[model samples]
Target: MSSTAEEKTVMKVAEEEVINESRRNFLKSMAFLSAVFAFSGILGIVRALGPIQMKIPEWPRIKVANIKDLKEKEPIIFNYPLENTPNILVKLGKRVTNGVGPDEDIVAYSQICQHLGCMVRFMPAGSSSEFPDRNLFYCPCHAGFYDADDGAKILAGPPLYPLPPVKLEYDSSTGDIYAVGMGPPVIFGKGPPGSTEVWRDLVGGKLVGGG
Candidate 1:
């Protein structure tokens, strides 16, 4: 072949190769822009959906006892927001967590056992052979013990969760003690085992008449 003709053919092939390369780059750019747009659209949709709303039920304020009337290490039995649910209000005689009143020794907790649907009895310090040094709640059915001075902590037995403590409020002017709310880990059989959904305690039973 003539040199001039061969040179012309090489130039044509190089021009076509460059044009093909430019087309591939353009397609790649378009694909990337389309993916970005799709991702942004998904994000916008999620934002438009907003967040979930949960309306918690109002806690009832029910008067349980008089702090002055309570004796040291003694328990006052009463039904709280739930008419069927029994609880214990006590003067531990020493300050503790979530305790109320002038001494900060007055506290309360649900009597329901965390292991099973059994009632627990209040045991003053030295009352139990297993845990004599601590004021505790002893479940007669399964022998589950809860620390009374503490936040009803599970000491031993099959109970998977801590006993739900009653949220107490004290009236200094009248020396009155009120049952206001409940703590976490829910109530026995009220929700999932060891759940923190305390709102479930309000359900499955009727609220007491008044504060």
Candidate 2:
């Protein structure tokens, strides 16, 4: 082959290689930009969602009842850290779960059912032959119930956790009953059912009337 023809052939190959290299570089640049944009899009979505605003409350100890004032099997409705969040305080005439005072029969629990936020009412022993036991916290909404004598354990129906019991403080000196804190599995609608974040119970509502 002629030397000139040979040089031309070499130049043509070099040009083709240069074009291939440029193509590869262009594809790499495009891929990098796509990844960067995808990550930015995810960040934008997170920003759009915003942060969850929670009200971290100072758990209050509010005096709710006087032992002498309580009547057996009667319920006194009151609010604790949050207004509108009703709790039932009762004296079952016998010792019970978290019961306070001399008889150990005084107890308190959230009125909200763990199943669906239905208010629970105290059903006295023998009040309903249909119920397996007395000293019951019953939810009429779905027929679900709790055993008041036993930490308000869910006895039947669809409740996921025990009725959230109110932590009680008995003043032997004053015969006063105070609601000190809420138990595990925070109240329904505040957080998720079975959530142990009791503080969430204090988040949504106004503090009990005077507290």
Candidate 3:
């Protein structure tokens, strides 16, 4: 073989080897990038699945008022857990009357609007100015309304569920009002069972009818 031909052959072999090396490096880079992206995707999913920590204050026993203070069809507003936490105590009777004793007429509920955490107020209904014919709860912020008697049922408005009713037990002996437990939070914008919504907006999403 001629020397010049040999040189040309060697050069051709070297060029092919360089091309092969470049291809291998590119493939390695692609593999590394793919692995990094896959790992990042898994981490993102883990973060999404992690538990959300809420900073709700410990439940405290709220002294609503003297049992005798509330009148029929009238409501009282108070705070619990902290001064900032608002609650509503209502006295329901067949007719407007005073004095609280062991009777089915006295009831209390939390005033915090189940939808978006707005404050709720008692709305009076009647032709007479002295006493309201009927009592209802109204949330001015989002027009959420709840029935006063029995459980606070969602009467009308954007709220999908009723206000959360706080469990009340009055000590007949002491005449001190005590809150035993709290009902599940009201959930808005969702139907019955399993669909998720914002916690601050609503509770368990179960709608219980008023008595």
Best by TM-score: 2
lDDT digits (tens) for residues 66-151 of candidate 3? 77777766777765433445677776664222223477566666677877778888876662243355567788898777777537
Considering only N, C-alpha and C atoms within 3 Å, which residue pairs clash in candidate 3? 185-203, 186-203, 187-203
Model 3, which residues run further than 4 Å from truth? 1-58, 94-101, 124-134, 186-211
lDDT, model 3, position 99: 21
Q: Candidate 1: RMSD over Cα atoms?
A: 6.9
RMSD of each: 6.9, 6.3, 9.3
TM-score of 1: 0.72
- Runs in model 2 deviating more than 4 A are 1-55, 209-211
Error of 3 at 87 (Å): 1.3
